[model samples]
Target: MSTYFAILTQVGEAKLANAIALGQTLKLKKMGVGDGNGALPIPDRLQKALVHEVRRADLNQLAIDPANASQIIVEQVLPEDVGGWWLREIGIYDEAGDLCAVANCPPSYKPLMVEGSGRTQVVRVVLIVASTAAIELKIDPSVVLATRQYADDKAAGAVMAHEAKANPHPQYLSKIDGEAKIAAAIAALVDSSPETLNTLAELAEALGRDPHFATTIADALALKAPLDSPTFTGTPNAPTIPHGDNSARVVNARALAEATQGRAGVQGLSGANHGASPANKFTVSALAVTMRNPATGQAITKYATGALTADVAVVGANGRDQAAVIAGTASVHLHFIFNPATGVTALLWSASADAPTLPAGFSFFAYATTIRYQGANVI
Candidate 1:
């Protein structure tokens, strides 16, 4: 029914027809039908003989060309049985039951021929068995079939077996077994030799305690000294006190004092005179005094003599007085004093019989220069 099969059938039929024509032509020439010069004339006898020869030539050509022979067999003898399923082989037979031709069927040929001959000549057809791979056949429920239900069923069994071989169940240790292992480990730690045990006891005493039982041997071996309990040998040397660069290096008080000879002593000033010198330490200048009115008891101006040439005037008051001579000689001694309470300076007559009186709250200031003599100086 495919177009490709139809085209192949057409090509086989055309080749068969061409072969039959060629065979008939050769047969006619051999029978002297178409040969030049004294060939058989086209009469009824020649025509009948030519037709018989052509039929015989076609049969002979069919044997020579299997494609033609198969075509003829399919068309004339097996026309009713030439389609449906694929044909493997085809056998053409004469009416006498002798095999005339055998042809391997083309892939496009269908198996539709009946086996034995009836009225027509026989053509045996061998059909290719239909494959159930492409066909879904219904199975009866009563029939039992053996097949893998799940794809991994067989593979899963093998995988489980391999896993069992690779990892068997572990034998677990009991609590008593674990305790026995720990006891054996502890027993291994205690030294059997008496000297070693004595040394261990001394070490324990030196540490002030026995070593703690540790889970690991390394932990047991790692002994640490107790805090604040280490015994140091010999006395530790005292730290040296660092002295500043400018500090004295003498270690004792007497050494320091000896090192510092001629230094100034404490609590007193050096290179100073404590008392007045033998020289006259006073000078003469203008002299003025303050007087008071005896009747009113109020202050009045009192004047005194100045040095050698002038008379002194009373300061902040109005009066003047000449020099005072004692028994024919002028008195030259003058005494000056300052009163901070009244803010005043007073010039006093050293030999005067009458003392100058001053008003309450009055002050004075004297201006003088230092007097130098050949034998001494006066300030």
Candidate 2:
């Protein structure tokens, strides 16, 4: 029986020491098996390569033995890989393709499918080092095969990790803490609220189970008129203002006109004042006047007398010297016209006994009702 063990080579020791000194990892890359000429060969620390390389592949895994911190376990799975050969020795290589360790295993025969007998092999090598801190335990998962024991060990480790702490997922609240918090929140709400409407279900029921209630209220309010500069349509009515209460209130136009002297009225107005003897020129006394426009029904007022000049006369085509024309013509009618838009007065005379035609834009015309007989002039 040959003693099966692996030892680090001189180059491997130097690399491991350098890695430990620099606080770096020694990356192991590949594992190679050899036949050793159909005989079990002894491993030498001075060996730079395998005796007769049979097959080489990337290591499946590298690990530090939990039971022995100073031992390294290198593993490779030959799942339906190369066969029809004898395995006598094995070697481990670093990333630079340098043999780091060598070992001899018990003589075993690997068969191919053509030989009517094929089997998968798992080769493991354990190397004893002073410390495993410098050895990197990483492998390319794409090119490696996971064994059942490896998967089971990992699953067991995950379970142990989960059981070691109260909350394995730190992002979520624990069951105990969550239950206590929820209970406290419910107690706080119930304590501050009435018994009839304390729980969440009661609040939901009070809202009639309509999620769009707030939106419905907002839409209804949007149809209403705003307080500022509100506009109304149709026969919108308000409280009528009192008889004489002058405050902020709505009143009809007719009521407002009657209350504010917006009507046709005159003060200290004379019927007609003939100018002296033959009544050649007629004048009327000054009077305050208030009247309303017939076109727009808007009231206007003024405190001024009527003026009669050549520009306002209607005697002849030139409209000058109204007394001579009035004395010479028979049945001459004098007319007083008022412009409600400008509160100005004008005069016109017609010889045929009817009132003269009112000028353009003059609506109110004042004519004397009683024809005065003064010194044969019919003044």
Candidate 3:
């Protein structure tokens, strides 16, 4: 009898087993063979028969079979004298050289150390294939390890993403809610009445209001009328001057005029006496006068109001002191004298001695003479 061996390293062991069972059934039908024992006898062309079985098996049909589910088997052994001692991968194939199944061992499995020899260490993996024939395969530990690491990293990243989604920051949640509220507010405003919001005040009135701003809005509305309707008719009322800490307002023109009437003059000069009556007296005096004598043709003496012995001395030394002169007749021209001691002066136009009377609107006075006195005698 020929020894038959099969090796399978990883998943899909059941697929090969199912193909083997189907091949046996078909062989029995074609050959009309009887099932004498539970196991079938090994045929001389066993490798060829197993190849035909694998070729006839449908992978898709096998996948639906519950018995075809992947089954993992792990075993450890010290392999010796099989080229390199590291077991990287194992594959199952039919003796006709058809691939059936494959398995990859973790490349991290190190070679076992040999005790007495300096040669390479040994590692082992037992691969069993349910098919009737064995297979040959080679694998690189580095390549297998790299592919596994890549898949594990992808899985870990997915897990991290799922965890992050489950938990979010508090502020992030609040910001999302705030944005939603603002969006709602904007939508409401867009849906509100357009005509009612003609001005900013009207818009504010149409919207929700705060109690704290009620008075402010009232004051603003009060100013709004004057600003909108700024036209003034007739004369404007006078502006009121505010007293200490008082608010200003408009006052009537009459009140303003009465308040300002007598306050127009200088502060200190008001009600002062201007001396408008004659009782506020001033002394009057005569000025000295000099005249030219007609016969001698010289300037006469000047007389001023002061202490003097006689009127003859006022006319200078050549003046005639006629104390015993003849009495002035009606035809004789009498001169009116000036007495400096009494501050009295007179002017004569006629010889009439009727108390030295003057004509209407006439007055006697003296004035300082501008002529120089020349020494001459007068009759």
Candidate 4:
């Protein structure tokens, strides 16, 4: 069983115990207030759906918190829709089924009661669910015998769904924040099965690699524009090009760092300045750039170590071959190209001035394949 479902079982046991021992009740809420169903309040089915989202903590038998074994119902959603899948708002109700909170993730409770009683006890409880959503399940396959057959490791669904709701394409644990979650998830999934474990490892690698789509979107949003032109070399190790920064240089650095965290930080940066009252620091990542020149004609420049340089003095408009990079002259058109696709006539995309520093394959913005599509039929 996945750690996710195992954890869910625990929560489920808690909820079941609370319902029986404390007699707490709950009601879930809908994403929007109303449509035409009068109150438009969340229906019990959806409430149960939210409840179902809770990972069942794997321990056998239900254990109720005697002190505060209160019934808790939770409904969850996202703060806003990002893309394909969206985690909606969550609703929590007390034993009496009253609104306790509306939030993305409700904080942990302090603790309700130490032990139970024939008299009464309010066992503190929490119902956790996803922030964004994709699909709903009426009958969870784990519990259902039919589903159990196909879902030997049912928890994959949760992790897969969550991963999908996140950045498109599988990513690796490269960034600081993503790495944390990936570590936790992978740890949880490791014992699931060898196959599952291997998949998780692959997921870790994917998450670690740069997703071109995400990179492109972030670049556009940073509002940082590349310099007018570049001087690239057909050489991979010593390509040279002219680079300059506008006033947005500093702001752009911060924005990019915020967007990509430190992965996109300036290179060749020194420590912060402690000389002044508050001191200052230098973020050179933004200043560093690799311009992707549109193809002028038919020519190829291989990316290598000696093909890159830090300064530019002159450039060759012929989009100089790889030889230009080895010399490292400033004024030149730098073309650092890597195409993620491996087919002939494949397109390419640029990350930094250097291409395929770590190569699985090439990078691409889009791919070409003949597909049939029907335009709006309404003519």
RMSD of each: 47.4, 28.0, 43.4, 31.7
Lowest summed-lDDT stretch of 10 residues in model 3?
25-34
Candidate 4's residue-wise lDDT over 171-259, tens digit each?
64458877798888877777665763367457656566545757866887666444655443464243222133233333433333323
List TM-scores for all candidates, in order. Answer: 0.12, 0.45, 0.17, 0.12
Model 3: per-residue Cα lDDT at residue 24? 38
Cα lDDT, all candidates: 0.30, 0.71, 0.32, 0.29
Model 2 weakest lDDT span, ten residues long: 309-318
Model 3: per-residue Cα lDDT at residue 290:
41
Note the residue pairs that clash in candidate 2: none
The parts of candidate 1 lying over 4 Å away from their true place are: 1-171, 192-379
| Candidate 1 local lDDT, 118-225, one digit each (tens) | 232222232121111211112233432222322365588788897887434435767798799888876776555355454666657656663653444456544544
lDDT ranking from best candidate downward? 2, 3, 1, 4
Could you tell me the TM-score of candidate 1? 0.12
| Model 3 spans with C-alpha error above 4 angstroms | 1-89, 92-110, 113-152, 159-172, 175-379
What TM-score does candidate 2 reach?
Answer: 0.45
